[model samples]
Target: MFTNKGKDVVEGSSSASATDHRQQKQASQPAPLSRYESQKRRDWNTFGQYLRNQRPPVALSQSNSNHVLDFLRYLDQFGKTKVHLQGCVFFGQPEPPGPCTCPLRQAWGSLDALIGRLRAAYEENGGLPETNPFASGAIRVYLREVRDSQAKARGIPYKKKKKKRKLMKANLDNNPNISLQQS
Candidate 1:
């Protein structure tokens, strides 16, 4: 170190300059969006576009579950997944032998995922968590209805697969020493 009157300078300032460069780089560029965040932004923009296309241009503040339901129905027009009706020959079959006149609607899983993204986006965009339209009971009921109808129409039963732990527990109940019998 050398001192010129009251000013002192370090012999090696590479580390200091490197840190400064890092700070400047960080300040110049924003962080990249994660997959989920990108999806949320897209969903929010889509909802905003839907609102703008409304008859009177609905505001985000005035949006409700009803508007969400309408948007969901509107999306049905673009769905590519086929959901068989009860009267269809392929109803209740996992794989249809031949194509029928079944209607194409948005898959239940896709709608569920979209609703999840929209719900998160609504809160992230300054909407009150309590007043979030996506959090309404109507939205839940609509999702449930969509899930059930889609399940029935597609003949895919909506049953959760049981975990192996539950089966192990059942075996443990039948034999008190089962837990200690592991080799």
Candidate 2:
């Protein structure tokens, strides 16, 4: 009888310890935020607000490529370009008049980064990665066209920077006529 009682106590203690371990594990783990979560949340909220203010109301998830492109164009209206940055000195007493009063255009890099964030946000909000509107080829092509057109309009080179070739000492030794000029 004593042996049986002792066995029962041992089982009860073991079960209690198991429960305690589970509780401890649950308590120790911290809830983590989703990837690019904050930016995604902000982009969604901004898009939501834009949709709300449209002539005919549109749902955020119902947005198409055109709507996304239009949203980017809208952002470009207020974006500050490099020229605007160059003219503005924040520390000056009484900001200079006519300090780039023109509304800034969005650069290619900024738009690309924004689109990436939006794509991540869409997936996080339960939109499937495969079917994500932001990840569509049409959207990417449209952005490329936009960037190219914008660069042309601004008279800026649309081509990416070419990597400079490094001249090796062996090459220089082979061609004695070649000489390095100090700038």
Candidate 3:
């Protein structure tokens, strides 16, 4: 004869057996998770990993020396694997080259070297446009070079004129309270 398992469900004769059957049925029933739900769970787990600083592998190409340096600069500027999606950086270069992978603290000491190299390159070449903030005095120097080159090519002489601004020099030695009209 069948027995009731606590609630009004049919089960085997022994109470223990009845409870076991009920448990088996419950366990056999499929979990109410859908495909979308399962995928969402997986996605959440992966995203969590990313948020926790576990990034996926990135393949990089080391074609140009400049590219390698720029990658290092990018890492120094931004302290993470993924730089914020800014327009300037996007057009500048794509990431991960040579041995470098993750972002690093800005190499403050390298700033002087970088600036010096930039200046030297500009001195060797003409220079970059003034629009480039990195141009430094390179723009003015380049213009001077261009002017000099033009003068040389044309076999014309150019002279630098010094414009002296007459300073109403302050007589600080005299009392400031004394009127200039008295002088």
Measured by TM-score, how close is model 1 to the native structure? 0.73
Query: Tens-digit lDDT track for model 1 on 1-183?
Result: 887578786757855997899999999998999999999999899989999999999999999989999999999988988888888888877788898888898988888899999999998889998998888899889989888877787677787777698778888899888764455
* Cα-based lDDT for every prediction: 0.88, 0.71, 0.41
Top model by lDDT, which number?
1
Which residue pairs clash in candidate 3? none
The regions of model 3 sitting more than 4 angstroms off are 1-72, 75-106, 128-133, 136-183
lDDT of 3 by residue, 92-152 (tens): 2333233323334433334334434444443333434442323446434534553454344
Provide the RMSD of all predictions against the true structure, rounded to 1 decimal: 8.8, 10.6, 23.4
Residues 20-44 of candidate 2 have per-residue lDDT tens digits of: 9999998999876575676677888
Residue 177, candidate 3: alpha-carbon lDDT? 67
For candidate 3, give the lDDT: 0.41
Model 1 steric clash total: 0
Better of 2 and 3 by lDDT: 2
TM-score of each: 0.73, 0.54, 0.20
Query: Which one wins by lDDT: 1 or 2?
Result: 1
